[model samples]
Target: MKVLVIGANGQIGKKIVRLLSPTNFVRAMVRKAEQMPKLESLGGYPIIGDLEKDFSYAYDEIDAVIFAAGSGGHTGADKTIAVDQFGAIKAIETAKEYGVKRFVLISSLFAGEPEKGPKSLETYLEAKGRADDALINSGLEYTILRPTTLSDDDPTGKVSDVTAFGKSSVTRSDVAAFVAAVLPEEKTYKRIYTFANGDIPIKDYL
Candidate 1:
């Protein structure tokens, strides 16, 4: 499988590129030229493309896509809409145009119910929800992973599909592992689920 990982330089994105590169060809979509070397060293075939600009150049010969890109909290609402919402929607369109078989999205836990999320991040959450809707309506195979608040702790290699795990957190590495594990599984191709660190083994879910 040849996979293209958008926002390949982010915390979870980098891990996805690393995990997929060993088993699948990876096109790590990075924005800056300086990020190429670091991503390449992680076994990814670094491809330079900005989400805020043209990214179609990076979709050539890609078999699948993982949209892990985000504008983050510090960036204002406009950048968030530009990168997270429209950027992800464009990626799905590009995947359809390029005949990519699967599209996986890295979304937030309360994306589908943003009003219940942080008030300050309401705009960002809405963007995610809209982007998720775009992918669902695009008529392409998709997997949407809505993880709870992320943590940097070492991975426990365990996760569960628990939508009501209040204040629960998941490690970035575990999320990446989960994405890599399920991409080839047809059962997960069209499902949208929430995951968090839990006693259940991650592999069991896949």
Candidate 2:
């Protein structure tokens, strides 16, 4: 499968590229061309693209796309909306225009449910929530994986089968693994699921 990973320079994005490059035809999108060498070294076809701008060129010949890119720890709400919400929406639209088969989004936990989250994270969650809602109803095959607080720990390749959060945290690598695995599965298409490190079985949810 030919996969395009937006935000391939992020912490989790790098891991996803490394994991998918060995088997799939992976295209790592970066804002700058200089970032190409590292991803290329990892057996990825690096493409220079920006989420805040036009991404029509980036979608050429792409089969699936992983919306893993986001604006980092910033203070302004506009930046968050621009990068997280609007940027994600743009990517999805472009994917549809290009006839991409599957779209997988890396969203955060408590995205659509603001009442259960802290006040500070409410805006960020809302932005992701809006994007998730848009994709869910976009009439294209989609999967939204909402994961709890992310860590840099390695993946155990063991996913919790449960959908409810029970005071558990998931590693970033595990989230990336889940996104990679879900994109090719028709069973997970159009499903919105959440993930964490707790001992809940993910197979039951799938």
Number of backbone collisions per candidate, in order?
0, 7
TM-score of each: 0.96, 0.91
Off by over 4 Å in 1: 164-166
Candidate 1 local accuracy as lDDT? Answer: 0.88
In the range 64-133, model 2's lDDT, one tens digit per residue, is: 9999997753558898888889999998888888999699999888887766776777778889899999
Which candidate wins on lDDT? 1
Best candidate per TM-score, number? 1
The regions of model 2 sitting more than 4 angstroms off are: 73-75, 161-166, 200-205
Candidate 1 lDDT by residue in tens digits, 1-206 = 98999999999999998899888999998988999999999999998898777789788988899999998745899998999899999999889888886999998887857777877778888999999999999988899999888889999999876665356899999999988887888888778878899888887866
